[model samples]
Target: MYKNLTITSLLGALTIILGAFGAHALKKQLSVEAMQSFETAVRYQMYHVLVLLVINLYDGFSEKMKRTLTLLFTAGILFFSGSIYLINLFGVSAKSIWFITPLGGLLFIMGWSLLFYKFLKISLQK
Candidate 1:
């Protein structure tokens, strides 16, 4: 619920702010590749935020499932988007932490999988 909605709203707002900052402020400061990476992070973060909002609106899930989805999505955003932000903004080499991005991607995949399972279960029950 409301907690998820509130967090998603904040995430959405931050995504917008970060996107604008990347476009205007970091455009000149970062390399073209770094800027692109940063933009990717912002895009994924926003996408998941929207997904979280949609999940919140869907009432078919149990509280535990909702919580699990929230946690997974939140962690995915942190690890995936946060790592890219750190690399581009702080000049951390991607090679040093190549593993983190994929782990985050895995979490994102798991979150979607759980959502799909729930939807299928609900549909089959009808």
Candidate 2:
């Protein structure tokens, strides 16, 4: 939990820094579409960071399960947000790698499904 907390906190911080950089540094450099895509990446990364923090607060899961949840969330952010960032900032055409974004979305959906399952299982036990 502590490890996830720390990782999430760092990720949160990076989200803020990147947001600021996008607003100020990349504002004039990138096209409007690219800027929007960059913002989408930052938003999703921050959203998952919050999800990680929330998961740390839940104590119903075993350590292994918690780790799995964390890994899934982390991977989701990496694949989803990472691909968006690359495409928007690094000039990687989205058409060339359209499959990656959906894969990341699938990871995010799986993470949420696992969380829901764990919480539901706990509620039934209670």
Candidate topping TM-score? 1
Candidate 1: where is the Cα deviation over 4 Å?
none
The C-alpha local distance difference test score for the whole of candidate 2 amounts to 0.89
| Tens digits of per-residue lDDT for model 1, 44-87 | 99999999998888888877888899999989998899889989
Best candidate, lDDT = 1
TM-score of 1: 0.94
Q: Candidate 1: minimum summed lDDT over ten consecutive residues — where?
A: 57-66
List the RMSD of every prediction in angstroms. 1.0, 1.3
Q: Please list the residue runs of candidate 2 whose C-alpha ends up more than 4 Å from where it truly belongs after superposition.
A: none
Model 1 local distance difference test score: 0.91
